[model samples]
Target: MSSTDTGARRGRPPQTPEQAEEVRARIVGATARVFTRVGSRGLSVAQIIEEAGLARPTFYRYFANAVEPLHAVLTASNAGLVGGITSALTGTDEPVELGIALIDAYLDWARGHGPMLRPLFAELHDPASPVSAYREAAFDDIRAAVRGTFTELGRPVPSPLDLDAALHVCEYVVYRISAEAGPGAQPDPETVAAARLTMIRVLLTTLGTRADVEYALEVPGLFPPPGDD
Candidate 1:
């Protein structure tokens, strides 16, 4: 018997939840690919459906418009970054250590998702775009994580405006570095390393203190050196 026939004969096959999740993932993945290629302003529902190999009806069933899948992707990415930073910080309360961990987590997430994030960043400031909502939600999550870390460390929590500014600076630095280091940019590894170090130092200094910044610099490999892979 054919593999499909044999498998069907053996038992009932897939269920709705698993199949639905797989379909949703495919839609999101396709949306990311399309956004990376054409950007948000140029994106279309038809393009996404074609990329996902789904019917138009299927696309509508899962997402309301081109922006919804993009929102879902950003939401998942932000949740993952927040979860990682939160878990990594469970027992530590030192300001420098917390700052380093948070910066590391943020950079790692950016590196992994930089291409996927480019379009979202482009649309982030547009109040009419769904990506703006997701963008604000992401910053909120990061701010909450930072506040919690400061509380744990017995340090004064930054005002919401201050936290927002710091986080935006961190994000812009990461995004700029990632764009320069992308496929054909051919940036020197040392330059990337320096950028990372500078980012960590600035963030720690802004959110914590000069002493915390100095301490982070002294801890070797606290910021991963470039080309370390």
Candidate 2:
């Protein structure tokens, strides 16, 4: 028989939870590689099976379809990104500083998840992808975190619509920043710097009071310090 159908004929099923999880991770990692190379449009079970070095039955043992692995990858990513943003909020209390920290957290995650970020960004609007629901929930989590921050500071929390809009703006900006690069590539320094500045402005306007925004503009080095560009 061909390798494609031989998994059942070859080795035993994972005897331990750890081994099962490891195998599952290999499938997820292969999904990410497929996304990086061809994006969602080109993703398929066959592609993932070959990339993961698994038989069809082997893949099916852990996942139900082509989309589950993609969803699995995104679930992990959303948790990490939202977690970072929440952590950023806890480390600072100044309104403008909070804006800075929030944006920095996003950029850090994007940079660290470079291979997957581009596809995740592209998947934002893919009707066939499960990314839309996941994206909405992830943003809501961020909004809740931001609201908690303002409540802790005794400041009025921004409206839900406003907070969501600001994040969409940043998402669009980063989408533009990384659009031209190939999968697994990062945008150049200049592009990332400019995108960061744009996002910071949108966020400040949306999340900060007028006085806070004004103070942000007047900060000589902190707002757009040397090396920021």
Per-model TM-score on C-alpha atoms: 0.78, 0.87
What is candidate 1's lDDT per residue for 126-188, written digit by digit as tens? 887777777788777767877877787778888877777777887777667756666434345
Which residue pairs clash in candidate 2?
A: none
Best by lDDT: 2
Clashes found in each candidate (C-alpha, N, C closer than 3 A): 0, 0
In candidate 1, which residue pairs clash? none
- Stretches off by above 4 angstroms in model 2 are 1-11, 222-229
The Cα error of candidate 1 at residue 66, in Å, is 2.4
